[model samples]
Target: MMKTRVCACQTKDVYLPERARVVASEPMTATERFLAFELESGRPLGHQPGQFVEVSVPGVGEAPISISSSPTRGAAFEMVVRKVGNVSRAMHELKPGDPVGIRGPFGTSFPVGGAMKGQDVLFVCGGIGLVPVRSAIQYVLDHRKDYGHATILFGTRTPAERLFVAEAAEWARAPRATYMETVDRGDGQWTGSVGVITTLLPKVTIQPAKTVAVICGPPIMYKFVILELRRMGLSDDRMYVSLERHMKCGVGKCGHCQINGLYVCQDGPVFRFADVAQIREAI
Candidate 1:
């Protein structure tokens, strides 16, 4: 009989030092925008869903934006931006030919390979939250055979505030994905559901144990939506979210993006509910 020795070693972190050029920039809606960039080496970003990239402009600064495109989409990657602050505002002014620095498709990704394999996924998004969740949603849709069912629930302040309207419409039309959207207030022209994002939760049917819930949104939206998910019997470990704060240096050295001991730039922009539930400032 042979005795097995268990050894533990820290995983060597890999950082992407590559530069990517913006191939196109288009308006997804009045407030939301999309930028497509191709790596200089022409290789795909090779990131899992729910991971984010640190986008930098030399004199301006850098911001953490989620990967909005799926890996199945080829060598290029896309980010959906909602022009909320200075860095995002500067990003909106960039053109197709502009150059930007990219470091990481980093942090923990949604547990797609774990709970999501052959299980249903419920994507709950609000405002710009759709940006990160879109990456995972698209991945599941692209690899439909590996998953069971997918439900996407999105909400915004108004019709004009809706991000990725065209893509949302297209996803709604896809047979494999169920898409539903709502707005807080609507103009007379709007026909979709009108209420806070939490309202959409009760309308959907999901098996808590067999479902993985991914949520991302503004700070306020997270609190309310998370409460609803908990009421639905979704375990804290099965719920995932992405956090956003001002990020100066993508590396952990800069304290500008810290949430207590966790650096938003390094430890996360994505964290499991089980991990962040104890951090007071995390929400």
Candidate 2:
């Protein structure tokens, strides 16, 4: 079993109550993007795939980003971030030695152990959505003998926006894993399929009753992907998705991150399709 530790912090500390160190940082893209940080004191973030962490830069505030590394790896945890907003812009400027506050491995994660044990898994991702789904894919790949076949169908706005090119190429070559990709529009050198993420769904074989579908993508991508998954015969309960929202506190006490009654910060950034379907603005 994993050990869970609880710590108390004073009121003046604006950090996430857990401080992680910057172990390694590298840019996966040319847009000033990089991933840097490691847990300092706590046990490894024992979380399922599709969960996120609340990272803070002291006075700079916090942002919730999905944990990109798999727990099964037992290496340093990782988060992939783009330099888009305030906190992310600030985060991009930091070097490898800087300190950042982290609180969580929070929220529900993809159902991987029991539910996915003997089932075929289909991962549909777009743009940065690959970050969260990467964890689960890595987990499944690591324990390939424990699960059924796995297929990954990914689409990005363009080839330049592809998140994990090298890894994606490697997974494509793996035995039990079939990797396929598409871009909305491609330059001349691109040879992969070109279309929305939904377009790739029909290319794969999905055994609905024996498969689970996990999707992560932009707001506009989720509904369409879910619709496609349903058309493929995957039930709502068998479909899972991770959501992104502005979050202030990692815990549920703060009202800043509430999506209706659900706290996106604590309750989930990941939810079953059935659980979030009734909640307006959840997509």
Candidate 3:
């Protein structure tokens, strides 16, 4: 695998954005929209998985959205936006061929190499948490022969709420991949496991010492899931998590995304469990 380059130092203003045209937009769920774009500059968005970009709408303002597609996928980048506020609501109104301002592919990313090299990988995602986690998952899949066993455990509130249904189906069928899914509750048509994601852990075979796990979800879910991971004999250093917080600025200048001494926008959206454990209030 080629080494992913860190972005070049910007001599010009970083706040200024380049023009980008929306190439596709579709509904992923009632609240979420999947959007793809390509820069007018014709440059590849060389972003690593777990990083995010600050998307702007001129008048509607900008918000940091995680890049959902792997950099290895294509020249176009993707984002999954949930309509919860003005900026995201405006984003929901966007369509193919529309133009928008693009700021950055900022922040830290998952350690797909070095520390994680040659280890069994277990991806644990909850709800929309899969959005960012999907990037890293795809990177692993793209270079399938480079890694060991890969197991994915995804959970949602209900069956209909599942995201990337088609892609997940394909991953389930991929060679050397173990995919399992669960829901907190099931509708009449549901036939899969019906329970919280933690319940699925006991059903999978994992080597706690040789495995590296990445988890992303709501704060409440993180607490319980991490507890279960601990119970499974996984050490804190071997586990990683992606965190979410209010991030007014994509860089560390703004304090909104601060978690104790770390900035989620700069230091991490992804962090090792050993470091986060030092902050009592962090999940």
Model number with the top lDDT: 3
Please provide, for model 1 over 223-281, each residue's C-alpha lDDT reduced to its tens digit, 9 standing for 90 to 100: 89888899999989888888887756666776987898998877777788899999999
Model 2 misplaced regions, further than 4 Å: 1-16
Estimate, for each residue in 30-148, the C-alpha lDDT of model 3 and write its tens digit.
88899999998889988999999888887999888999999999999999999998999999999998999888888889888655678889999999999999999999999888778
Minimal lDDT window, size 10, model 3: 5-14
Candidate 1 residues lying further than 4 Å off, grouped into runs, are 1-17
Model 1 earns a TM-score of 0.89
Better of 1 and 2 by TM-score: 2
| Number of the candidate with higher lDDT, 1 or 2 | 1
Report each candidate's C-alpha RMSD, comma-separated, in the order given: 5.5, 4.8, 5.4
Error of 3 at 69 (Å): 0.7
lDDT of each: 0.84, 0.82, 0.90
RMSD of 3: 5.4
Worst 10 residues of 1 by lDDT: 8-17
What shift in Å separates residue 48 of candidate 2 from its native position after superposition?
2.7
- The TM-score between candidate 3 and the true structure equals 0.95
Q: How close is candidate 2 to the true structure, as a TM-score?
A: 0.90
Residue 194, candidate 3: C-alpha displacement in angstroms: 0.6
Clashing pairs in 2: none
